[model samples]
Target: MRVTVIGAGAVGGALAALLDRAGHEVSVTARGDHAVALTESGLTLDGGFGAHRAGVAVVARVPADTRLVIVATKANDTAAALAGVDVPSGCPVMVLQNGLGGDELVRSVLPGSPVGVGLALFAASLVGPGRVTVTAAAPLVIGGDARSVAVALPVLRAALPERVDVSADIRGAQWTKLVINQVNALPAITGLSVQQTVADDRLRRVLGAAMAETVAVGAALGVSWQAIGPVDAAALRPLQAPGAEGVAAGEELARMLARGMGDVPNPASMLQSIRRGRVTEVDQINGAVAAAGRAAGVATPVSDAIIALVHEVERTAAFVTPADAATRVSTTQD
Candidate 1:
């Protein structure tokens, strides 16, 4: 398969490397310093998995021969990154992003091609120019079937260590992922890893409340989203101790929280946005919840507060300490 990946940051870099190693012709679209680095030196993969270098074509613009186009750019860069890409009339584009709007945005931009939503369970970071670190092993959930499963699945399965589940309901899966993402903000404030934040008894309370709020909105919007990964509250409780009786019941939460933080040196995506002076995905994540809350007549004061705080950090371009964030999140329920 010939694959054109638009964003060569963490998600795009990892996907390009994996696909290239799987014997597909992978061309990455990058610009300026990142493109120069990839041209001079191949991409670097580091973390729990042993690092391997694979040869891939680097280009400043998308060519005419792209078969499957994967848009893995940040939520904010979706429009501009897509503006340059030239896709065939029938080529399928999968949006692997962090929030709720990828499918619609792509459809609005490129109406002819089939657009699908992808839920990335794995954790990856662009450690440096032309380098990506795989922090945790999580499945990449895909929706839509315009492309052949026999052709694309084999390539995806061979490249990624995590299993790929082709979902009939991609929106539901995204909502489920969003339910888990509510805690992403918490880790930034608490200064803890994903597992550590879930393991802490007090932090677990804060996260649980946040997720419950998201779930309320999800239910109202007719989207079914249950937290599936170890990121869920049920998975976090056992890591604390059996005595933590108030948390949800689940066996995998403990094991998930027990796993070592893979290779995430940078903060989670939302936290990174706050640090980078970019607008966080609050509008898509918690803000989406708040919007749904309004339609469904559900009160989402907690989500509203988190959205405001993160937006303030986005506008100010100052490092909002995790402790301060934790204090804000902790007080929301009261």
Candidate 2:
């Protein structure tokens, strides 16, 4: 299979390397020094999924005969990322991003192509230009329009490690991932690894409130929750209670997810974006929760607070202390 991957950041870089290692013809589009590094030295993969170097075709433009196109850019970059890539009609484009509605965004971009939206359940970071490290290895989930998913699923299963799952309801899977993304906010705020943030009592409590609120939003909207990693509708049942027990359960789940990522100091993708001085996707991840809550007439004060804090960091380019962020999150609940 000839695969063309745009946005050679962490997810894109890891996918390109893995697919190339699986003996597929892989070409990646990247700009700036990252592209230069990939061109000069190839891609380096290490950590959770083992180490390998995949020498793939690196280019600034998509090839005409590309069999598959994978866009792993940040959610906000979805439109711009597809700007110049003239995708072949009917070619499957699997968009891997966080938050909700990724497939719809792509559908609007490449209407003629079969489009499936996806997310890497495992955590892979672009540690450096041309380098990707998988701190946590878990299944990658893909689903959307039937034709698009059919085109992308088998090829992904063959090339990827851990696993590749096809969700009949990608929105449900995304909602589950969205609940888990409660972890991404504090890590971005405190400049801490996910483990470090989960270990803080105040910060953990704040996130717990946010998670419960998110579940409320999902339930109000009647979203069917799918399991992504350790999260599923059943696992989130405790959060429906609206009390300490629910918050505790949410915290425990967050801890389990952090433990799954290992002790490699995963700063998480949002924090990585903050460090790079780029915009974080807190809008799509956390802000999306608040927006849905407003429309559904549910209260999401906690995650809404987190969104404000994330924006503060983006504006000032400085992370907050766990205590300070906790204070704000708790106050919002009050």
lDDT of 2 by residue, 75-165 (tens): 8887888887788888888889888766688888888988888878888888888899988888898888788788788888887878888
**On residues 29-137, what C-alpha lDDT tens digit does candidate 1 reach at each position?**
8766768888889887876444778577887666677777888887768888878567777777878888788778888888888787777777777767788888876
Model 1 misplaced stretches (Cα beyond 4 Å): 148-151, 188-192, 199-202, 226-266, 321-323, 330-333
Give per-model TM-scores.
0.84, 0.97
The alpha-carbon deviation from the true structure for residue 79 of candidate 2, after best TM-score superposition, in angstroms, is 1.1
Of the candidates shown, which would achieve the greatest TM-score relative to the real structure? Answer: 2
RMSD of 2: 1.2
lDDT of each: 0.69, 0.86
Among all windows of 10 consecutive residues in model 1, the one with the lowest summed lDDT is 242-251
Relative to the true structure, candidate 1 reaches a TM of 0.84
- State the displacement of the C-alpha of residue 64, model 2, in Å, after optimal TM-score superposition: 1.0
List the pairs of residues colliding in candidate 1: 135-263, 189-322, 235-253
